[model samples]
Target chain A: MSDLRSGSNLEKVLKAGHFAFTGECGPPKGANLEHLKEKFMPLKDIVDAVNITDNQTAVVRMSSWAASTILIQNGLEPNFQMVCRDRNRLAIQSDILGVYAMGVRNMLCLSGDHQSFGNHPQAKNVYDIDSMQLIALVKKMRDEGKFMNDEEIDGPPRLFIGAASNPFADPFEFRVYRLAMKIAAGADFIQTQCIYNMKKFREFMKMAVDMGLHEKCHILAGVTPMKSVGMAQYMAKSVPGMDVPEALIQRLRDAGKGKVAEEGIKFAIEQIEEFKEMEGVAGVHLMAIEWEHRVPEIAERAGMLPRPKI
Target chain B: MIVANPKPISEILDMIKDLKKILILGCKGCVTVCNVGGAKEVGILASTLKIARIKGGNPVDITERTLERQCDPEYIAQVKDIVHDFDGVISMACGVGPQFLSEAYPKQRFFPAVDTTFFGGAVQHGIWAERCAGCGTCIIHYFDGMCPIARCSKSLMNGPCGGSAGGKCEISKDVDCIWDMIVRKKMEQGRLDDLVRFKPSKDWRTARDGGPRRSIREELVI
Candidate 1:
């Protein structure tokens, strides 16, 4: 009924301080093995964990399992993402066990992008179970030591399960409420959708405090810097439920043309500084997108220096 | 087959309002293939609506059920006894299914769970590409089994547009140029020259721009 092992790694990370570092990388489209090795090397010592996106935005990418295998082989921590849209219960449960064997210790369960949102608009979404049910299923697998098929695992995964939350997108009151359900379903930590409004995020933190969720789960605020004004507009309009505050827009606007990259880093660091003081805010997940090199600068500026000792 | 479109959670929650007895209906037909109306969708929609409604201070009684087919009269007849038990019926079927259900049971108020999108067939495992425009015309023989009107990005009668690069559409790297597939198919079948043959511009009258199109055959009517 309880997962002492699931929370053990996260517990160690959380105790290091109220500050931590995480990053996300969208897997390349092709199956080039060198691409995997190249992507993980830059990420190894820099991040506490690196997230391997599974066919993000519905574009065809290498399987997260295969990519994670390479990451684990390279002695890097892989935060594997598994979406319910592509597989059924049979495949999901089996894959969870298989990935554990490959030494992928962290997982982020998601409902996934609608097929309509993906490049393949016509693909079927096999949401055999929603993210909540999948979370519960994983927890059940860990606690009971059996999969959905009622088969016993040789060694159940010591998975530090994480779930996603889009505070900017979900209704203000409901966002924290939904996150509470994810925590209740056994999400060890929360990796939010891209964070744009630090002021609004502070308000969300206040609400999380009110709901007692701040005490219950580790919250990793997500930040992805905008590459251009065009990209900022694209994220605001195209990414469903993503909010880009006027201050951020104005900062980029004031930075003028071609200087938006500089403005984006400034904005992200500002968010990181603000996030530092919030109680129960476990850490920050900095998704540099393609520009991972700028991460050390952002972390240095945010005062998240020195690798977290866990 | 029942085909229904997904409605936003807010919209569905609004429809239920203060209704205590709610039934979430699902169709295991075209809607299932489309991922909008099915047993799984019914469960998800029901759970989401329940959570949202409960949070909004109005408690709702939610029960989910899915039928093999919604349009068929036999399946429609099965829900009659149970229809009166719920305050309202949320029909997760094609536009036609709910209309038929309403016609069959005039006493019950029916609400459609899904918005009907289109009539199409599955192009791949999860992707269903539109094939027929319901224009009441058949041109499969002329185009060598490829429907330019439906599949072509630009609806080009003769294509392989300059925009196509490496079989990907120029509009976005994601979309496959349907014409590219056609050309490759034609060449594979030794009919590359067949595409060059003159075919007049498509008649607009047959398409929706002219008016609604219909087909009737007296011999099949009996």
Candidate 2:
């Protein structure tokens, strides 16, 4: 038994200096457990851990903790994500304890997308705590065995905490500093927003390295293989905080109609190749959202297959 | 100042539909400044309601009155003499006006004609923007005089959340991301360090989350 924070596979893989590969799976809108299991089955041994999103994009879905429990039952480690959009502090802390008890060892703290972007546009949001405060709350729960109110818990949730960073978001200079803040708040690992602008990402990573944030936390570069030119264009124009460079869109366009997806995968593979050597990049969080079936192939091509047994 | 918008004539008409006589009361305070429930608006509303009722084949007798400020007891007392003369009173002030009127004259039905929205000021001749949430504690000085509690969509203390882009909020292109403004202002002043410090979880007790709040200045009391 080696000394480790959470001792989860994701933590062990990163700790042992293996270029980690993680995947994301958004829970279904309805409780279709078999369908949900099928979506993540390909990633069981292909990646170190699978991130289960909590009402991703604020659209209602199966709860991340419940989905995480399902993954655990299926013999996979889950990076259970909790967003501050739906749950207040009371609900958040309670869910944290409940999920940990269900054998969840990894968690990702996020300030979820605003409710207006979700299926229920009129739904009231609960941001009783921001992502930064949430990070601190989880760390206190794990490290001190205490809740936000400083009450001692009989059993603490010793989990590997993760946070999300979007390097493409505006006031661009502040992005790195925000990453540092999350790390300071006690995030052990980070999975950034999906990257398309490698130049900007490199600059952002450079700043993180300069500030020594990479030394404190494992920074996982986010990768999402574009499936079509429309997907690339939509991400570029519609998605906030997404920097889908024109060059990547054109490359997808140039790869005639039938081959755009292959071009997209090629681009993602190229990115994975570069990220393997990029300073401050400890892993790649491949979010082939709704495109999970192709993840195994992408992982194999990126040379991340046969994940470390540690 | 408090900003409000007049409830639609259809809604106001529906409220007073059963009454033949009604008082269209206006406030000469925040509602007046926002051009919603001023003395002039009271007269217009009275005439409009009369036309709407007459066209609907049920004529209504409307008596227009504008108080100095319906939120104050003194102004509320002005309507006492004629309070019983009308079937109902339509307070064309903010939501507070109708409540105060109802409390002052429990027997008479006071209907709010305007929906009180927020503490804001007119940005232009016809535009109003929210500026304060009245969160009880004022921390704008920390962020170079901008309030995220009122402006940011999520009211995040340590934001611009991931949704901030090109100075606009994710909710709408028209709404400015207040955190963006705060961050840029701090950067321009070479005070970027001001925002680097973590803003801990807000004590929402200061705000309405603690429940309906009250303030009593000891010196002014009694």
Candidate 3:
């Protein structure tokens, strides 16, 4: 619909009038490259781009850049996720260039999960720049080839900047406005936190559409397939900004023993189908966290497969 | 005001172990308000230290004193007359008290008895909550009086950063997610437009990120 400025496959797919599909992969806690690639093996042909998480949930992990570089070596495009919790503006800007030089085109800027949630709760946080400013910082870097200090870069890292939105977070009415803010800050795409509250998500999407945010940026609904009834209960209770409704938990419980994952996938398929026609939704971001093997089945069942090739 | 907690008695005992005599100085300012290093706390700490030292086969003579404010030079000067009576001073005010006392009496060693946690006010009588980070620049007007810089564990301006669950922070169930509060405040005030655009990167230079900051009021200066 517009000139492909970001040049990311995820961007390309969305721009070319195709509903995009993205997957996620967290770098392992240790630097085991073979283990990393084995995880990506299932995701290689399953989705258009893989979101390489940076210390996801604030747990210490192998760097997203390192994991993404390996993914690139395996021929899978990566959506590099950079969080603002551990790094300040300087490290963030430097890493942007480093990851881009290493062939990471898709970038997701996030205000990372707090360090307290991770193994390093004693670690001093460096949230010198939040996600909103990070979005602007990237916009400045990409459009003007400049740093946050108004300094110029030699060869600007042309990255497809993405941001995260949690529609389930409190004050539901403001979630759409926050998404609008991220878009206004120059996000090319958005991947939300996992969804189980479709009713709330729809209301959020309706507001986003009302604000014409979908016209501005690609919004991908995050879906995490509940592997079991226990997983559903855990997400419903523990996960932050995740709105796993009790009914969904009940449905997962009703799935009985081995069929829970499929039930969760079926629910995801339903969400994807609704998102396919939903006014503001551009795609679904399948976050089968530690369950990468199910991506192919989930994608195929959701009718997102034969992963739209340009 | 600075809210702080008293250091563990074990740590305090370790700090003053070798000293046979020490002063337990308290501040009537923030520490007093926070119920940490107040006059009442000074007596308790002095008694505790007395017992801990006696048990360790080294009885320490502890003199308890409470100043108007340990952070003020004038209040610190009040201790000058009796300063040499002890080998060292265990200042029970927040981290600032020890430093101030140390600066005033360079020869007398000062150990911080309380851990300075945050610039906050009292939520309840015994409960103190962090409300300000002393980031130098104030933007609380934007968030309906809630300061994300101080309250949010991450100090996120564009937040509810995915880890906020049921109005609680991901770090702990005890902490109320400030962004959640801000959002609710905005919605209550019907000011959704306030958050509709990209809030620019915080000018951290104005914050503690710039370095040790100082505010000089020209008119108030002598």
Clashing pairs in 2: none
| Model 2 per-residue lDDT tens digits across residues B31-113 | 99999999999999999999999999999999999999988899899879999999999988888888888888999888989
lDDT of 3 by residue, B1-222 (tens): 888988899998888788888888888998888898899999998888888788878899889899999878988999899998898888888888888888888888889898889998888878888898888889998788999989998888877676777788878889999988888777787877776645676877887678888889999999
Error of 3 at A32 (Å): 0.8
Can you list the residue pairs that collide in candidate 3? A241-B164
Strongest candidate by TM-score = 2
Per-residue lDDT, model 3, residue A61, is: 94
Relative to the unseen true structure, what is the C-alpha lDDT of residue B183 in candidate 2, on a scale of 0 to 100?
91
Candidate 2 chain B minimal-lDDT segment of 10 residues? B187-196
TM-score of chain B of each: 0.78, 0.98, 0.95
Q: Give the count of colliding residue pairs in each prediction.
A: 6, 0, 1
What does candidate 2's lDDT look like per residue over A58-109, in tens digits?
A: 8889999999999999999999999998999999999999999999999999
Q: Which of 1 and 2 is ahead in lDDT?
A: 2
Q: Give the per-residue lDDT of model 1 (tens digit) for B1-222.
A: 323468777777777785788887888888888888889999998888888887988878888899888878888888877888888888888887778888998887788877786667666776665676554466768777777666654455534433344566544557766766766676678874575443433545666756866568889977
Deviation in angstroms for A99 in model 1? Answer: 0.6
lDDT score of model 1?
0.74
lDDT of 3 at B169: 86
Give the number of the best model, judged by lDDT. Answer: 2
Q: In candidate 2, which residue ranges exceed 4 Å CA deviation?
A: none
Candidate 1 vs. true structure, TM-score: 0.59
